[model samples]
Structure formats: structure tokens, C-alpha cells
Target: VLLGIKMSPEPLKKKHGRAAASGEKRSKRKPKRKETFSVYIYKVLKQVHPDLGISSKAMSIMNSFVSDMLERLAAEAARLAHYGGRATLSSREVQAAARLLLPGELARHAVSEGTKAVAKYTSSE
Candidate 1:
């Protein structure tokens, strides 16, 4: 699904190396930390439900649920991609993510809206 997003799956290290050899200075940006979708979902879920009983079993269940939710959110985001191209996720993406991440919970509505509102402000380039 991320194929058409034009994102490079591999780091452009060779390109950077060539540029450096040619006396071109790279921006020196920090490398991006690798994260699985499950990890991303876990963090969001943890933020939403800070005290989910505090047991290993409970944490395991939460992780499972978050992974499931991330799958759902990814599907929704893929659907919404029909309206946009390889752009950064927008309000729609957040809504989709929140809906899947916190279904039937009171925080869902607020988080969904908040994601959109925050995206609007932060997305200005």
C-alpha cells in the first residue's frame, strides 16, 4: 500500500555517499527511528487508556487490540487515499485512525476531531 506513496523504503545512503565524495555537504539530519505499525498503534492506545489494569495479561491484550486497530485504521486510510495522492496524512487519516483505535469509547469522538484540527494547523507547508 505504501508503494505508490513515493516513499523510499531504503535509506539513500549511496546517494549521500556520492554527494559527500563530490564535496557536497548533506543536511546532517538525524536518521529516522524504525517503528512497526503495531508499535505506533500501541503508543496511541496507551495514551488513550493509560491504566488498563496494569497486568502483564492486560498489557498483552491491549497490544493485541492495538495491532488489530492499526490494521483497521490502515485500511480506512487506504480507502480515503482515493481523494488525495502521495501526500502526508490529513484530517481524514486521523479520523480513520481514531475511529479504529477508539471505537465506542467517549474519547474516540474528541480524538478524531482533535486529530483533524491538529493536522490542519501542522500541515501548512
Candidate 2:
């Protein structure tokens, strides 16, 4: 009887494996890199909607989503650069990739914003 129920007459077979040897060398895996964007996401959300509140769970989801989106965008931009036979990624390739990825007025607005940002950054240096 097992747990007050009837059991099979034959006992379960035990699985066998080599026991761990204390002196044996084991392979070590590299630590995974963790990307965090919670604080940045929260700050941006607050800036855009000052009166709105975001739950911690929602913020975490948004952070992951935004990080993934940015990574995809950068990867697409790099692909565009490669397609253009250039080893280095440039602003032009990024702009072209953004235009290809974004639609209509959004593309225009994004390009303009990017241009403004580049100009500001260059002027600061």
C-alpha cells in the first residue's frame, strides 16, 4: 500500500548514473548578461504621463518589450549597413532602416527627431 492505496507488487527500477567525483574538473559556463531598463522606462513614462501611474509588473513587461524592440531595430540597421556593402554602421543606414521599418508620417517624424539629436550631439562635441 502506498499513501493508503494499493501498489504494484514489483518495485520501481532505480536509475543509475555515475556519482559526482569531488576531484574531477567540471566545465564552467559564462554568466549571462542581464539588461535592465526599468528605471529608464519608468522615468520616460512619468515624463510622458505625469498624472498616470504604472504597476511594477506592467513596468517590467514594458521594459522588456522596449529593450527587445530597440535590439531588433539596431539589428535591422546593422543588416542594412551590411547590405550596403559597408562594414561600419552609419547614420544614413540607420535612417534608411527606420524609414523601412516605420510607416508614413511616423517615419518622417522619427527621421527628423534623429537628425535633431545627431546635430545636438555633434555640436556638443
Candidate 3:
């Protein structure tokens, strides 16, 4: 008003949540999801197609696929261990499980990858 400019009242700001709902400790971050494979899935997808976007439906299917794969792998590994009379599971059982569950080249690749992971883990320890 001093400089001949009209000053207008600022529009009211709307805040989310209750004004008087006190005593609750809330975090600004999203809660960690039960299925924590989202990061891995996104990384794998990005490796194949950097510019590609995943739909929620496709992501759900991917999560289900990962869950099924893990279940089958674990079951097969446990079965192999049980049959071999071993009280503990080892890479051998996992390799055999992969061999039995996966087809041909995929099985071979899985064993190789598992071997690498085991080696890395052991060497780190």
C-alpha cells in the first residue's frame, strides 16, 4: 500500500490430517512393505530396459513369480537335504534343487550363480 500496490490476504492453506489429534508419533516415510523385493525387481527390470516403466499389475505378477520361485526352490532344497540325511542345508542341496526344478541351461546358470554367491559369502567371512 505504501508503493501503491494492493496487498491481498493470502488464501487459506489446507493441512492434511486432524488439527487436534495429538499424542501420536507418525513418521514421514512410508512403512517398509512386507514383500521387500520391489527394489530388486526394479533393478532387474532397469538392467534389461532402462527406459521401461512397470505397471502395478505386472509388478504384482513379478512379486508372485518371485514368491513361487522361492517356495519351490526352498522345498526342493529341503527335500534333497532330507533324503541325503543331512541335518543342515548346504550349497550342494541347493544346486541339486535348482537342477531338479529348472530346465537345462537355466539350472546350470542357477548353480553357477549360487556357487558364486556362496564363494563370495565364505570369502567375506
Largest TM-score belongs to which candidate?
Answer: 3
Judged by whole-model lDDT over C-alpha atoms, candidate 2 comes out at 0.83
Error of 3 at 94 (Å): 0.6
Model 3 lDDT tens row, 50-105: 99999988888889999999899999999999999988988888888899999999
lDDT for each of the candidates? 0.64, 0.83, 0.85
Q: How close is candidate 1 to the true structure, as a TM-score?
A: 0.39
lDDT of 1 by residue, 1-125 (tens): 47665555885464643556453466788889854444555576679997653555666676777678668777776666655674576666757656655648744765756877787888985
Q: Enumerate residue pairs that collide in model 3.
A: none
Pairs in steric clash, model 1: none
- How far residue 85's Cα lies from its native spot in candidate 3, in Å, is 1.2
Model 1: weakest 10-residue lDDT segment is: 16-25
Q: Which stretches of candidate 2 lie over 4 Å from their true place?
A: 1-33
Whichever of 1 and 2 has more TM-score, that candidate is: 2
- Which structure is stronger by lDDT: 2 or 3? 3
The residue pairs that clash in candidate 2, if any, are none
Q: Mind giving the per-residue lDDT tens digits that candidate 2 earns over 16-104?
A: 46444554454566899877888788788789998988898898889889888778779999999888889998899889888988889
